[model samples]
Target: MTHLPEPPAAPAAGQARIDDQAAKLLAAVEEAMRTPTSYRDDSPLPDYGPTPPVQQPGAPAMSQQATDVGRAAMFCGLATVPPGLIAIGILVASEHADPTVIGMICAAPAALAVPILAIARLLRSAKPEPEVHQHFHGNVTQTTTHSRTSGVWAKNINQK
Candidate 1:
């Protein structure tokens, strides 16, 4: 039989000490990650000083009422063609008159109505609503002014 030399036993005490130190270091890292602290403690924020006022270009302003009137007028103008066509179709189907006469009769009403309605809308929109004044008392002086121009007359407010 061949004889073999026995392997040396590992240094159990030294290995145990090293493992304990490693576990402690891992736990310290985990704790630090869980609760972070600022590098500069008890320090105030740095100031950059006062900022200069910026100039902005003034935008072209249009009143809500005027916008509504313009939109209504546009819609009326667009609507003129459809009703005229419908009227002419009805007249022709009924054999009320010649094609030329039917076209003139139908077109006249539509043409007149469109302008009248547009003018009416404009006139109605021109009437200004009562102004409202709100007063605020505080360290900062603020005054808010607004007018009530919203109603059935302002139906085309969102058209713009």
Candidate 2:
């Protein structure tokens, strides 16, 4: 087998200069590591004050109250579906029920529940009652009450 040629030798002056610079850089790095430098907080430091609020441009504009009402309506509408299907199934399985009657029975409750829940949510979120304060003359008694609407007829009063 033929022998491979010997590798080329490094140049004397340039190689020595590169090695000298590398050793100097390594020694500078080691000295820097041995004695650490202290950092100073310079001009325009961070303020500890509360940050300004950022408004997103593409965010939806729906109000929380409207979202809550819509969510309630959606849940009620979904809840009514299973019951409506069951009612339809029962009607269809019966011997003498007409197709139109079965359809109506299934459709009515599902159709009504959404609006009913929406109305209930609207009524629930209606403005709180006017504050009532009563003062006594002699004993200096004071009472404050808030009225909460529980249902169509009844209201529960809370005292503070």
Candidate 3:
């Protein structure tokens, strides 16, 4: 390997001499190293601002019969399934299926009843949503608007 004839730091100077610029650069770097940054390791972040207040939603507006039916259906699906499954799991795990068929016979009827009862209640309680149907002839102008809505809503536009 051959070393360059000039010192490693000094190269060919085609334009402005870096000797003056280099001293300024080195002094700036040294000053920056000595100075503290605007950010401190121990400091907490500054607060941006408080958030806007939110309005609470209103209570559910449902008829007594509808509410009761809805609750019953909810109970059967969510409430009954878990407990029923856990009960069957516990009973089977305990290995208490006897020479007599009485244990399974009783549990089978109740377990089967849950789905039947849920289906029956849900079907009976279910109400159909109101519908809109528009029939237009030639040269008709139609406008449609759909939005967030609750409960029953019915409107007839351009009706005689």
List the global CA lDDT of all models: 0.74, 0.75, 0.73
- lDDT for 68 in candidate 3 is 94
lDDT tens per residue, model 3, 32-136: 999887553555555787755445459757899999999899977886677667766766888865645446755786899899999998997687866979888
How far is 44's C-alpha from truth in model 3 (Å)? 44
Model 3: CA > 4 A from native: 1-56, 78-88, 91-107, 110-160
Model 1 scores a C-alpha lDDT of: 0.74
Per-residue alpha-carbon lDDT of model 1 for 1-160, expressed as tens digits? 9999864455465455556689999999999998857443445545786655445448556899988998899998998788778876887798876778767875787798899999998999899878867666777765455446766676333321
**Winner of 1 and 2 under lDDT:** 2
Best by lDDT: 2
Instruction: State the lDDT of candidate 2 residue by residue for 74-158, as single tens digits.
Output: 9978997887777767776886488788778768866988999999989978979678666657866655464556567885656
Model 2: lDDT equals 0.75
Q: Tally clashing residue pairs in candidate 3.
A: 0
- Displacement of the residue 16 alpha carbon in candidate 3, Å: 54
The predicted structure with the larger TM-score, 1 or 2, is 2
- Candidates ranked by TM-score, best first? 2, 1, 3
TM-score of each candidate structure, all chains considered together? 0.27, 0.29, 0.21
